[model samples]
Target: MTTWEPKSDLHHYLRVAREALLWKLDGLSEYDIRRPRTPTGTNLLGLIKHVATVESGYFGNVFGRPFAEPLPWLDDDAEPDADLWATADESREEIIGLYHRVWAHADATIDALALDAAGEVPWWPEERRRVTLHRILIHVISETNRHAGHADIVRELLDGAAGLRADHDNLAPGDQAWWEERRLRLEQVAQAAGQSEPRP
Candidate 1:
């Protein structure tokens, strides 16, 4: 019989979200990974970079255990959203490598502290600045999974590749034709519903 561990379970889910986000970049060319997919300029590589910076801060500085490398992009004087998009000079490997390092640093922090260990969020409002490892873990996991969800859509928009994971897509089993038919059916329903609505 396996004993239930809350921290272990949380860490496992966090790792799952992290891997899913990174998996979105696999098998894509540099341009595809870095090109802006949305009007606001969201991209695969940028998502990874942004999450890395986020983890580095929440897990690193929040716990008084800063990540070794300096992140100039996160500095106040830096251009807004600097961490959200990689420049031409930043290679895919570099961004991915940084994420891996951040994961290691974050994992170390998790291992070192108890779930109830106290920490401070310097950037948060004063009343809410005080936190615990458990709270931070939940926050980081939520943030990572939220961005992973973004990667899912951006990746599908780029290449029609969509899934919760490579191994198990977590989608209904259907061929391309089946999916197209389903989409057309849904579109018809949407149009019908719209027409039935009373617009002022």
Candidate 2:
């Protein structure tokens, strides 16, 4: 067996989380991918756009290695949360392409810096801005995976599709009918429990 390296393991998890978020966009049309399915305006393509900007900022500007590309959405004059959604002119391919490039940029930072390499997050408070490569990697990995989980729910709401990945679903074994029955059973239990509750 190969020896475990902290950096390599962290990178692997980060990549996995990135892929999981991207996979939610698979087989979706421009309209569907851009459609906000939740009250919070969560959408597949928007999530991709958001994460791209997120990675670019965290790995680029935070580390003093800024991305060459100009992110208009992240500009000082831009509206708040502009990076959270795609505009009309921004095609799906364009956003996805940007995300891929961001991944490469982030990977380059990870590759070049040692785990102990120091950096500062300019946007963060002064007292807590200083950080190391190891801390950033863990933070980004956690952030990416959190968005991936949101994407999973958004995709499920869109088409009832849910899984950890293409190869492994990690869901309990059940046919469509079985799953429906399970849902009904849960609803019944919930209703019964609600009825038994004493008046407040």
Candidate 3:
């Protein structure tokens, strides 16, 4: 919960969150980043790759910075989930480099546009061409944070370790046993109501 207004200057907070999301992959092996974190194999590196490609598209292609890279998933002939997971051949550095490039292009777009500056979304319906930087900023921030939350859960599932970082803030440090009992009570309440468990 932040008290700061998410305005034109809000890029700082959004950028921090985005970086934190990427930092989740730090110290992880190439295998770790590519390993299945979910039934659908939502690995950490894959999520970063997806976000990088998407950020490049929305902020780059939309605004015309146009990041040039050979994205296999972008190919019409490739698997739809290609960007969703890493192949054995892909290295961690390669994916990270791609993400950094995408970010650079995205940042360039942001630097060029004012909050009120208007542009067009080419893929939208014909009547929806005109859009403001404010809208794009909001959309990208929402998209990044949404995906990052997925990353958070996936990372925690990968290891019992959790939090935005791997350290001091991970534990609540207050009546955790009581909290655990309360959680179990909530689970019993839910089970009594015919629910299996809480969703996320």
Candidate 4:
């Protein structure tokens, strides 16, 4: 039998998402990790950087427990989306290290507070700014998982690697030739559907 501790369960899932996102960077060159893969400039390293900043704010400042380290890129005067991309001077190790530190800090906050502990989001609209630890945990977990999904797609686009995790890809078994045939079949079906008359 397993005891269901809600907080612990949420934390476990959050860590899963974090690890999945970071794993996307493994075995990739610096250029590959940092290069913009999407038209909107989404990249693997940038995704990690952006989420670190987000977790720092939500788990740190939101609960009146600010993360000790200063993040100049997150400052008000800094350029927009400064946290989204790492500059040439910012090595991959630094960004990854910072995220690990953030995990420690956030875990502390989660440990020290109860699910119902009161907190306030300074940036949220006044009426809804007040929140509980449970709410914040759910919020951050959702955010982390969302970025992890993005990481999965971006990593696949980069190197043809796609999976839910290193050990378990959670994908149907298929070789490259099988996948190619499947893709062609889907494309043909899509074209046929496009040619069908509207059902209005």
Which has the greatest lDDT?
1
Which candidate, 1 or 3, has the higher lDDT?
1
How many clashes show up per model? 0, 0, 0, 0
Could you give candidate 2's per-residue lDDT for residues 154-184 as a string of tens digits?
9998899999999888999999999899999
Candidate 3 worst ten-residue window by lDDT: 165-174
Better of 1 and 4 by TM-score: 1
How would you encode candidate 1's per-residue C-alpha lDDT over 28-76 as one tens digit per residue? Answer: 9999999899999999999999999999999998989999999999777
- The global Cα lDDT (0 to 1) of model 3 is 0.77
**TM-score top scorer:** 1
The residue-level lDDT of candidate 4 at 93 comes to 99
Model 2 off-target regions past 4 Å?
none
How many times do residue backbones clash in model 4? 0
Write one digit per residue (lDDT tens) for candidate 3, span 72-140: 788889888788777788788888888888888777788787878777779788887778777888787
Per-residue CA lDDT of model 4 for 1-200, tens digit only, reads 99999989988988998998899999999999998999999998989999999999999999999999999997889999989899999999999999999999999999999999899999999999999989999999899889999898899899999999899999999999999999999999999998895977
**Candidate 3, after superposition: displacement of residue 175 in Å?**
8.9
How large an RMSD does model 3 have?
4.6
Q: Cα deviation of 71 in candidate 1 (Å)?
A: 0.7
- lDDT (Cα atoms) of all candidates against the true structure: 0.96, 0.92, 0.77, 0.93
